[model samples]
Target: MTRVCRLVAAALAITVPAGALVAKPAPKRAVAKVDWTRTFGTTSAGGYVVGNPKAKVQVIEYGSLTCPHCRHFAATAVKPLLANYVRTGKASYEFRTFVLNGIDLAATLVARCNGPAHFFPMADQLYATQPTWSGKVEKLSQADQDKLNALPQPQMMVSIAKTTGLLPIAASHGIPTAKAQQCLTSQAQADGLMQMIKGGEELGVQGTPTIFVNGKKVPAFDWASLEPFLKEAGS
Candidate 1:
């Protein structure tokens, strides 16, 4: 089937039964019950971290707000990762910013506006609705587009956020327009985002959704590829 479906099926195959010719139901795999009290906090680099602070395996995902593949991975992989690994104290997960463009930068700012507690959920919302917000640019007139392109970097980001409906998305997630505007205009936030981008570059992140397990780059790019690494590390 499609790539995402294939990836998901492969992921399921890890825990689910492999037989297809037989008519018997597959045996259920037992997942550890989530504690729901796992630690959540901000990393020194401004990324969000969730799970046991001293877990043996650490997963760092460098993702762009504008990347569809990153969104797909988030949708299909994160839930299981959190439940089976992070919740069980087998591994910890962190998300790092890797902005691909101005839109990505703006989205990152808005997502981080509410701080660490809201960061992951806001990020999930942004990725789930990425196409809606990102597609709004194509509907703008040439003059308007040029004006947007001509604004100072911070204001340009704010304008992009408003134009692309990202502001409303933030508001719905508890950040108001005024506060979001402030976040978009914050020089400190901009600097942090830039630094994150630089850090991603130094880590050799050539694309969105680049994952690292225990400081080693994951050779495979999908959930199926990552599962084995997590298992090996956790084991």
Candidate 2:
């Protein structure tokens, strides 16, 4: 890990053998630890996190769902990031939404359907299918766009979700169309997402897919540039 690693080093957790922390008696053979990759939590900054909470290395990403750079990074980085780093319990990964616009917010709400455990999978699928739907709304006539922008919360979300195909993508992830709409209309959730944008601003984030390793901003914009940094950080 880098110098920034020291900042969080104070959070170190004592290590014990697998299942040692539980009440069950020690087994004849070692019981494997629960997969850190499947574990999920929320960071104080409102980012959805996965992996060992006390991992030595920390990887945080702030990005806009509509940003092509973010999509490209997600397309390549996600699998290996989970497989090699987060899953190993050496690092944790967190994604803070950098809301760019109404469409991005709608997409995020739709992707977040079913709650935190389903968030990553829905987001992953959204990125994978981005090329298919991300551009549709952009092609709207100026008048149509004006109308969409003038609409209120749930209506705007409904229009954007339908136009961008977010509804179907959500459906594919087991979020029924009605459930997706409910997620879209959630005023509290939308406000929380907006707060995440403000949080990103406090961190001096200026663009999509910003990477922070152990609290240090790194110049990694994609998987190729990011992998080395994570590896150097003990990934």
lDDT of 1 by residue, 1-235 (tens): 9999999999877754566547987899997676632578888877889888888999999998899999888887777788778888888889998888888888889989988667788888888888888878868899988998899998898999988988888888898999999999999998998898888889898898998999999874666878999989878
| Residue-level lDDT for 107 in candidate 1 | 89
List candidate 1 stretches off by more than 4 Å: 1-38
Which segments of candidate 2 are over 4 A away from where they belong?
Answer: 1-33
lDDT score for residue 123 of model 2 = 87
TM-score, candidate 2, is: 0.82
For each of the candidates, the C-alpha root-mean-square deviation to the true structure, in angstroms, is: 18.1, 17.4
Overall local distance difference test of candidate 2: 0.86
Please give the distance, in angstroms, between residue 45's alpha carbon in candidate 2 and its true position after superposition: 1.4
Each model's lDDT comes to 0.86, 0.86
Candidate of highest TM-score: 2
Worst 10 residues of 2 by lDDT: 7-16
